[model samples]
Target: MSQLRSMYPPIEPYSAGTLDVGEGYRVYYERVGTPGAKPAVFLHGGPGGGLSPEHRRLFDPNRYDVMLFDQRGCGQSTPYAGLEANTTWHLVSDIERLRALAGVDKWLVFGGSWGSTLALAYAETHPDRVSELVLRGVYTVTKAELQWYYQFGVSEIFPEKWEKFQAPIPLSERGDMIAAYRSRLTGDDRATQLEAAKAWAIWEGETITLLPNPAFSTSFGDDQFALAFARLENHYFVHDCWLEDGQLLRNAHRLRGIPGAIVHGRYDMPCPARYAYALHRAWPDAAFHLVEGAGHAWSEPGILDQLVRATDRFATAP
Candidate 1:
């Protein structure tokens, strides 16, 4: 564990369980903090990613009852990336069902990146069910954002990593990296899928973590991290995240009265700070905290501290 992890109070692992969402799908999650305390649910990023133990440290275990669940087709969830019935809408519905199963009428929604996007979507659909929101690394599935990620933004700065990311596909397919990676990742050729997964992981790892040029860890190999990642990326990118362009902000009216906070890194290369600023401008009532000298990494000292503080405030505030 990092020294930073030790600074926070120990988070005791609570119940590990699964919620059946029908169609042979099961969502797995773990609870931390006091069970009877105010409910605060965490939405992990990555349409195919799962929650990590360190993610639970964002909240003060003594003051809040924290719930972290892997979204459908990710983490401990069954039929990983099966996509038989998985969709953004299905995710929002799964949340509603989870709340009912957990017996919480309302809870704070905490998410970052893709998680933040889902949080906004859910709050828009069911504002009454959300008591508040604390979002980090906001990602609004806009075409501009997608284009930037796939072609212009990160690649502009990290050309070396970009080169590796594009090595698997020919120059002709480079223009449509998402499609190329999806076709290879979903194809019967395991070696090709693994190679694509490596590239994808390398690109993501280089950007999301603070460590410089971090090497890909094989520990997640058995976890099927690559397949799950490619599947979900294809699922979202293919459909533009199932949004009709600017749908999130256009529906911002639903969250007009909700108490919310946005924490973003000014130097973040993954999602960029511009998106956060735009969201803050749209929802002036929501507090926005931009951390200087921080990138997209959650492990950055300043960024992590701010994130935990935000959650602490939301968990304790009346």
Candidate 2:
């Protein structure tokens, strides 16, 4: 097996399942590894995006009971990006519900990028329920972070792509890329939505992975992918991730004593290492692992190895 495969070996075959979390909504989830092992839950990024098979490898199946779930309106959930009870608070409640359904008193939380933001928020609200945290490519959803992602960050690094993303919308609309995309994506004009989605995906792809191009196609040819991408991003941004200003940091007091490890790529463009540094300063007790040459892609061998190791260590600990 390749090193990547070895680090994240497939576990005992498991089946996918869904739960009715009330309000006529169902949350989709999958299980891997043994039932009696230490529980570890994976939160996917994109708010609207659901968990993928690759996410299961972050923990050692022999030692950890791994769970990957798509939040409401995401993945296999009943309504894709359905805004009803889909705020950040609702997500936290869903995690609690999932824990009870999975029959675990506490579980390790593993997340990256936007997932990391959710993990932090959830941990803050339910510190006692979290055994530990394994986070990477930390995203806080701060005003500065959003501004950087939309206006200054990727544009400074990849000006050509930035220009293409900005060209479709007028200067007045530039202040809020999320709003502009929402207008286009929800309009009656299919062509407009396609153009806007392409621009949005292109800008996101350029910064998220190490590759020069996005892993996803820009064409709205895939209805599911395009709809999920557009809807989830808009939901999170419109609500500022359902977080007040500096809420994550403000809530750090709850997580100050938690056992946690943060892994961030030094060169990550999506969520800069500076955010990781700020997190470290707040929770000085947490371990910070800096991946020198990697970007934000968790698929990178170095990041995968580090993540697996962190999970193993946390799972095996007393």
TM-score of each: 0.93, 0.92
Largest lDDT belongs to which candidate? 1
lDDT string, candidate 2, 264-283, tens digits: 88888878888888898898
Q: Which stretches of candidate 1 lie over 4 Å from their true place?
A: 1-7, 210-223
How well is each residue in 1-318 modelled by candidate 1, as lDDT tens digits?
Answer: 334332256565788899999878999988988888989899988777678787888888888887889988888898876877888889899999988877888999988888999999999999999999988888888888887777778898888878888899999988888888878877888888788776776577667744574343453334378678767866787788888898998888779889988988887887878888988988876898897877776667767877776776777665
In model 2, which runs have C-alpha deviations exceeding 4 angstroms? 1-6, 213-223
Q: Candidate 2, TM-score vs. the true structure?
A: 0.92
Q: Please list the C-alpha lDDT of all candidates, in the order they appear.
A: 0.81, 0.80
- lDDT measured at residue 50 in model 2 versus the true structure, 0 to 100: 72
Report residue 224 deviation for candidate 2 (angstroms): 2.1
Per-residue error for 203 in candidate 2, Å, reads 1.8
